[model samples]
Target: MSTSPLPRPSDLIARRRAEVAALLATDAAQAALAIHGTPLLLLDTARVEQQFRRLRDALPFVRFHYAVKALDHPAALAVLDRAGCGFDVATSEELALLVDGSVDTARIIHTHPIKKPAEIEHALAVGVRTFVVDNDAELAKFSRAPRDVRLLVRLAYRNPHAKSDLSSKFGVGFHEAERLVREARRRGIRVGGFSFHVGSQLDDPDRFVHAVDETIAFMSRLERQLSVRFDTLDIGGGFPVGYDRDVAGIEDIASGIRPSLERVRGRYTILAEPGRILVAEAATLVTSVMGIAERADGRWYYLDDGVYGAYSNVVAEDVHPLVFAVTELDGDAEQATHRWATLAGPTCDSADVIAREMLLPDLRVGDPLASPAMGAYTAVTSTRFNGRPLTSIAVLSQAPATGEVAIPAATSGVGGPQPQTVP
Candidate 1:
């Protein structure tokens, strides 16, 4: 029997383009443009909820915690909270977003391996009971906590292939992990389980499986040697999101690691922190050409938003999100008219280029351009460098009955430069 072939990268790109086109054609999107105009992010809460449900369905036995560091937008948090998903926070500010949203503290986990004593106290004061640690000093910081507090030792499984090798910064190897766990026990701290992140934007499914299997084996061996029984295993979020290409879907990665998790399902609580995969496709960025110039290299188009704004993912995450001109989406621009142009961001810094050698139609000043799969690590990682205000986010799917787009108060840039409508 023959099976249907998987989609090619081009096919995936085409699908994304179609989806973005459909989204831009919506009344909500148009209304957003008419109001907030370019340099805007259209956040679809429905897409966030849908991605959360997909993760749950694919790995039904594992509990998912949305990584708040990916996108701290209130609407995305509200959608995931309403969908009964837990949260994983790395900083107190991220936790504050959840606290302000009135999210249940019991469903939240503080996964930052290193934290200040004051931060720990704040989290504990806010009713967060679970925390993760990778070093003896961090474990010692938790020693004075209440008896009900639980800790998870973070193990590092390095994946050089990942866009970000998270292990390089945070996470412990086998020997250090063993030492931390033992030290936690000696200090009378209850080490409930272990946690690990393979890496961020990792496309290798086997890497996930290997990490899971290795962590489980280590847990079992340590339990036997130390005579301790653990109750939880946190597979920290590093699930990949396809940007300008096809990558392993959540189901594919889940399938590879499910069997390993299934073996210990009854004995342990399996938890996953998913950030990128859940929100990457939930937002689309719309930018406008601020100026056009012919540089020594080639024709250059400067956009209102770039690496320091919504396209910060380009530099921070090392991923290329595809950009399309609005005219191309409307099917008004012909392929023959397209040319390779360098796209630059609206910043005084010469390094503010968004993309180089980009094939785009002859765009003029004020021509609108858009990029999809921008929900994760985009706005959250954005900065106000060169006195440029943060790009405004317009909530698309959760608009009121009157068809008005809702821009979150936190991101509205109330006293900053007002968003100008595209002419």
Candidate 2:
């Protein structure tokens, strides 16, 4: 339960704005942004460690596996690895990052539900025996696998409201999951447990708890019906972070989950594959307005980054990252007048636009725009669209008092150009 009156969404953004401003105020941040030019990502490994520690403290019973697909910045990985968090890899390349980084392979879990036979073999050869599969064809790949191999059946719990409803692409329903489990047993494969992603950036802690309850209940039912047991329960990552606004607090989400886990604590191994939460706050995207134009709609400021690049989260996830002018961060925000302007990305494709009707101060050409909470999908899912080079990342130093490095508030216009506003 919330103890104090929860801070307003503006308060949350103001807090992040201060953090981002402090980081930008530092000479290091300035130098990096200048040297790297517009459209740069400042990744602080320290923040990654911080977020992981937060998760650990909130849900101490759950083993966290940093989903490598989130940021995958070697700097971020190094921090997480040092913090003793495991890795959850979905692709051969992601697994390679861990192996090449000399991470203990035992600490890795390959959680992609569908994969080529070669990919599975590659992971297995590297000592990653734990994998997630949702279908019979995926299970058949392990018919000749060693007894050391363990598979986690991926279950689907559709959450249409989630930013990314992973269930549509992966996971088996209850009946399909049971069949997959039995099939694994028939193939003489060791079934580890069940796993499900409660959708990306999910806000409902109750939904998270519901998914856990449902999965646990299903596991119990399966154990009784098939006379087999599961050794793990992978609650795939959907832990909400303050993006645009504070979603659900970590403790709030944990409160909903802990009771369920305590009842089954010693009965099974519990795990989580956290992607966005771990690294989302660890990085911020700093872009510069390359050109300002008076478009048919209104004033448009085109930045060096676009949806195909760092702002890919905006286009792909349908989530907007706050955009702020340097004047705002410098504590010289012009409040007397504010105009709603369009922030467009630098791609030839018109769809590359980042945000629309974003309220802002009178921004001039070459003004720096910072987007927080960009450490996650922004970089990993970005592409080299329009021949623009991928954004460069600068690793920041540990400065706990500087400010939190969460995602830029999703509300671009919520507190536009205010000293308390963050991107």
Candidate 3:
């Protein structure tokens, strides 16, 4: 059967450029950019907290564990921490980041399906009891652990369309999942339940319903066949966040997920790992045009930050961030003319190119370009390629400040955005 193709970016996408433009023209953003210069990320802690509240309101019954891998920024996590949100950590550093923040370990769950013995021990030692495992070797690592540690078998459901096909690298098929549970039983390890990531940035909400229903059935069948009851079902993170175009709304997804989850209520503890949806819109990347060049093909405007920097999301996830010129935001929409330009990063590598055929205003040296929805994997996955310094992040107020804004203290190496004065 032929399926309908996704609408073009312009048609389905929200008019986010105006939002980013207005934000950049704000007195606070301007002052911050003026002081810190370009390659800055403007993060709104309030945005993170708001997103958390939105998810909670949508799926009131499901317990949310903010995926630390999405954006490990301490300030961002602290916002969620204060919002009474739980956490999902995957590595020693991620766990340490939370523990260092003095967050309650009881509220955190380690969800990496495979880990080195040392990593497992590290998380276990730090009061993380709930873990994910998909194979014999992973189950064997927990053999020596305390009986309290509960393991969740990672089940694989391949969806090639997901930004990241997590099933290929992680999770196990049904037979392997059943075998893992049996082995865990043989080794006297407690099996809590099962976990599977449908995929990341999924636009389809019905897929969630299908997966949840399938999982609930599989668990019930396993209980009858293996004489074991699963107590928890982790509907791992796959919630979509809009970037280049609009995807399914969180409420729309919850509508589909809520009914299915109602079937398992009172019997199973429902958990969801939300990474991109919560943090993707909490920040925006601001980069300055370093130089304007005319190559043989066309005009190339080199920006200070590129694929190896804050634009990593573009390269890694194929998420096209809508770029807006600061000039347009300042009510200068009537530029000399608009033309297609090749946006390149400061990196020397050819692959560092950000976008091609970008219809932009005639840009000059030092013109600022802003990309919204940059709060997720962009900064977290960024590299220090070409020895460029990390971009400074500026934390802004929920509402426009009348005067000098307050700067949050640096929580960690990935510091909070410094405050920028509005007046």
Off by over 4 Å in 3: 1-14, 331-335, 398-404, 409-423
TM-score of model number 3: 0.92
Itemize residue pairs with steric clashes in candidate 2: 244-409, 244-410, 372-407, 372-408, 373-406, 373-407, 373-408, 408-423
lDDT of 2 by residue, 1-423 (tens): 111222233977787888889878876676666555667787777778888898899989889999998877766777789889999999998988788789999999999988999998899899998999888888898898878988999999999888889999999899989988888887788889999999999967888999999999999999999999889999999987787877887778888899999888899989999998888887788888888888778888989888998888887777768776767776655442567888888877878888887777777888788888887788777888777777777766553455633322121211111112122
Give TM per candidate: 0.93, 0.91, 0.92
* Candidate number with the higher lDDT (1 or 2): 1
Provide backbone clash counts, one per model: 0, 8, 2
Comparing 1 and 3 on lDDT, the stronger one: 1
- Backbone clashes in candidate 3 total 2
Give the per-residue lDDT digits (tens) of candidate 3, residues 1-423. Answer: 112322333743336766687677677676767667778888777789989999999989888999999888877888899889999999998999899889999999999987999998888888999999988888888989988888899888888888888899999988889888888898899999999999999857777888888899999999999888889999999999888767898899999889879888789999999999998898888888998988887789999999998898888988887787777765555534677788999989999989997877788998888888898888788888898877677777554344455444322126434433345
Model 2 quality (TM-score)? 0.91
Candidate topping TM-score = 1
Task: Give the better candidate number (2 or 3) by lDDT.
Answer: 3
Which portions of model 2 show Cα errors greater than 4 Å? 1-9, 334-336, 399-423
Off by over 4 Å in 1: 1-9, 332-336, 399-423
lDDT of each: 0.86, 0.81, 0.83
